[model samples]
Target: MYIGLGIVLIVLGAILAFALNIDIPGVGDDTLGYILMAAGVLAIILSFVATRRRPAGYTTTRESQVDPATGSRVDHTDIDPR
Candidate 1:
């Protein structure tokens, strides 16, 4: 989702920067375009960083054990304990 958003932002920024020529009161088209492009780049980078896979040492496992106090079966789940 983030990657897609970044691509869209980049595309929109390119259009605003190069395709159209409009004069606004306080903001210039080029400035807005540059800002959008920068934001898009940041988003793309952040998405990649956030979605990276975990290290090999990380693992998830489930085990069944009997509870000594309760004297009943119980399910235990462990994730990346180390």
Candidate 2:
């Protein structure tokens, strides 16, 4: 979601900064557009960093098996270290 928002902001900023030409009393269109683009880039970087820091899902289980030669049952453990 955040990544998508970042992409949208970047596109809008580019359009505002480069494609359109307008004049405002106090605020400059190019300046605002650059700011938006910068903000979008920052959001994208933050999203990437946040996703990288997330912990992966994991599952663990135990299974029982019988040994043919010994005629004995053995238990085995399995773990996912994601």
Candidate 3:
């Protein structure tokens, strides 16, 4: 999925950016290397944001909560939506 591709691109970019310090040809100079690294990092971050899941009817609470739509209570301690 997108997550996998993001991880791959990030890792590959890091490798390419550093070039293993082996001195490879056609890899460009330090400026281009840094740009590539920045672009890759940005891409990965965007991909993560794009692929994140947001559940519907979701509510944020640290304690017992009331379901907004159902008007029911969700007791965290009881594990029962009563």
For candidate 2, lDDT tens digit of each residue in 1-82? 5888889889988988999988967988898889889889999999999989877997789999999999999999989877
Residue 74 in candidate 3 has what lDDT? 82
Best by TM-score: 2
List the candidates' TM-scores in order: 0.65, 0.67, 0.37
Candidate 3 steric clashes = 0
Where in model 2 is the C-alpha error above 4 Å?
Answer: 59-82
Candidate 3 lDDT over 18-62, as tens digits, reads: 665545577655545566666667777777676565333544445
**Please, what are the lDDT tens digits per residue for candidate 1 over residues 1-82?**
5888898889889988999998978999988988888889999999988877434466789999999998999999889843
Model 3: residues >4 Å from true position, as ranges?
Answer: 1-28, 53-82
The deviation in Å at residue 79 for candidate 1 is: 6.1
Query: For candidate 2, which ten residues in a row score worst on lDDT?
Result: 24-33
* Deviation from native of the Cα of residue 70 in model 1, angstroms: 28
True-vs-predicted CA distance for residue 52, candidate 3, Å? 1.6
TM-score of 1: 0.65
- Pairs of residues clashing in candidate 2: none
lDDT of each: 0.86, 0.89, 0.62
State in Å the error of residue 25, model 3. Answer: 14
